[model samples]
Target: MSAFFPALTAGADPGRTAVRCGADTLTYEGLARAAGALADRIAGAERVAVWATSGAHTVVAVVAALLAGVPAVPLNPRTGERELAHVLGDSTPSAVLAGPADALPAGLDGVPRIDVDLAPAGAGPVRTVPDAVRTGPGPVLLPAEPDDPEVPALVVYTSGTTGPPKGVVLSRRAVAASLDALAGAWSWTADDVLVHALPLFHVHGLVLGVLGPLRRGGELRHLGAFSVEGVTRELGAGGGTMLFGVPTMYHRLADALAGDPALAGALAGARLLVSGSAALPVHDHERITAATGRTVVERYGMTETLMNTSVLPDSGPRPGTVGVPLAGVGLRLVDDDGSVLGAYDGETVGEVQVRGPNLFSGYLGRPEATAAAFDGDWFRTGDMAVRDPDGAVRLVGRRATDLIKSGGYKIGAGEIENALLDHPGVREAAVTGEPDPDLGERIVAWVVPVDPGSPPTDAELAAHVAESLAPHKRPRVVRHLDALPRNDMGKILKKALPGAG
Candidate 1:
């Protein structure tokens, strides 16, 4: 009864496409019937593990688990065997729902498997259950939904500083609040068709991308993969208005815009273009806007915090900022000494702390780690940020990797990285701090040169940084790499960089 979507589909056209992924598609009626059927099969299960993939089966499996009122633990399909096993041991799921378990990944052996039969969309008759829900005879009648707001809905596993990925338990209430707030922020509705090619394991893809549209009774067209052809094909096929992507996808889009007129026009025609997971470089933002006349809105979020801030759809783009704290989300900056700052002059940097309904209930099994993550009720996000007087929050970088202390001046690595990126010789850049006897921590620049045959020197990069930012913040050490190592979400793996402090 506390679910967000069942009632949303009421009075709406059941024949409408709820999800369309490649050749596979599902109507609203089909989604309800399929989910209700699977829900009945796993009625009393406490937890279910979904082998998250970009397919109709994975989407249906997750929806079925939610309908059954069970906490769903989404497993990253590409995760290593050891990491996958740790997740299974920590969050013992009653069943693992997947398309085909034939080539089962390592660590999933001996686990109960519920094969999700993905019927072609719109093929089956929508049979009605007793609770005004349409269900097929595939699994039987679903259990009556109980009105429990605090019920654990999702156990999204995120990697810990040490050991395996720690599961973050997000309650039903939290999910509901987050989706509703986002709807208001983005002017989302059922009439709009959302387009995205993001992965289904992380929150950006699963929680928001998959579930958000369903909750609002909107049509979603997933590209299955990110490609310029896919984006143009989907968006160009009328009614695809909203698009979601990370910085990498946007960067590719921006890079190709000059040569592709159809792509630029299709992007310009979109109602909204959103970028998240990592900061989109200012250069890319400016290039896309210059070509397409459409600015990509950036939002900030994490596995632990579903969504914190977003640049509104109507708000003109601010190159480097991720806008203000979303509705019902409280944000503050905490200095290194643990004192909360009162004013935002846009210069002082502090660790961002947030308290809101969107936050997770706790880290599963590790209660001490959960307690340590929060200061009272406010979650201490290790990201360093500087808020403008107008309430826009600009991320500096991670406290662990980007905050460099040198020459009695606390410097942020993101600004230096951006400055280095502005140089024509630099193809890619990441900034970190290495300990030095004179400066305590000297600023170091990791650069991917545009031309390896004639690369920029450490002195040239140092002068570039000095011209762009404060002289003290200039990089004293420059190391060139062929390319920067990035994670699945397109975030630079700072720890993976050599000589990181």
Candidate 2:
């Protein structure tokens, strides 16, 4: 039996709810039987793709693929034709598992289609794994011998910022390690019931939000779509103990808190509130915390590294930081000269590098890219950050986009964005570096003003940022916009900004 989900084999109540999406609810027994039955159908397949919708079908299909020891690649429902074609051509899965009613794009027409059945299991106690689908004991530690198979469990693709999205191969061991580490950090247990409305295509929503609960024998309540009303109903009903969301969701919540008392009350009742995929602006963080007395914790990770650092539930929230390295993960910062920085002064910014069992094995069919991604055992994250004396990490920005070397001083765009967000005139802000004859790279601020008709002047906004942060960190140029371009996960697409490379 696979050891990833112990709730099934732990002799727990069969009728306990495992996953709930809107009106659809699946008990532990039901999920086990459904997944095990489907696992039997594709036991020997090398790889499979799942049309990742925000629904129970996605959860069940992914669980089944993991049970059968086949790598599952989650395809975003909104992927464009060219990118979709690239992913399909790159991964080359034999079949595509999708919900019964999902209208898969023509790009997937060539692959054999397998409709995941979401029917309830027969009335009886269920075995977690049927004999036909059992894949050994499941998910061993890393550093497996060369002779070991080390089959990957998932092939999550990166957001094609640099090029066509590369398939990141995540082994079962890596997934299990990540979940276990998070369980320890958050004091997560079977008693907790999680609530979220995040899409199932990414690691934050699928791996940690869905699989994390299953690993800990907890319950998951997924909102089909993100709404403050949904959050209130789920968390206020006395069922949900935790909530997970991205900065965009939290930002909306912060905005609604002033008018919606129910939302504030519900958020206050939750035990843990987590934000990931991008940094939560300090302005929004302060607003939410002040209204609900619940500080939202932030965690840092990517497709290649499942999770590296997170703010523990017990630790008081640091508004701008993503806490410390998770258990079993080694985190360090390296300067431009490739020297590891020994200071935790929180001023010197360096490239964040991490080594841990929770990391993906490699990018599928891209050995050269994989080799370039690693410096020895440590994965070169390409994220720039600084460490506090207490070991908390504050991510400045991505190496390719966020770090701005201007006038002989290196700057991170996040602090400037946060400073701009602090201004009442600014509604949304994104910072980038553009080529400059004098500063090498000039700091540029793309802002969405609170009032479009009468926006703050560039000089005024620049002074606001300079007063809030530092003169050098202030935006050299400010561009007003209707909105910032964002991905499904609500991360700002900096490369899409004007004048960006």
Among the numbered candidates, top lDDT falls to 2
Model 1 spans > 4 angstroms off? 7-10, 120-143
lDDT of 1 by residue, 13-111 (tens): 777899998888888877776676677677779899998888788888988888778899998888888888889999999989988643667588768
What are the clashing pairs of model 1? none
Roughly what TM-score does model 2 have, to 2 decimal places?
0.95
Pairs in clash, predicted candidate 2: none
Clashes of 2: 0
Candidate 1 overall lDDT versus native: 0.84
Off by over 4 Å in 2: 120-124, 128-130, 133-149
RMSD of 2: 3.8
For every candidate in turn, the CA RMSD to the true structure comes to 2.4, 3.8
- What TM-score goes with each of the models? 0.95, 0.95
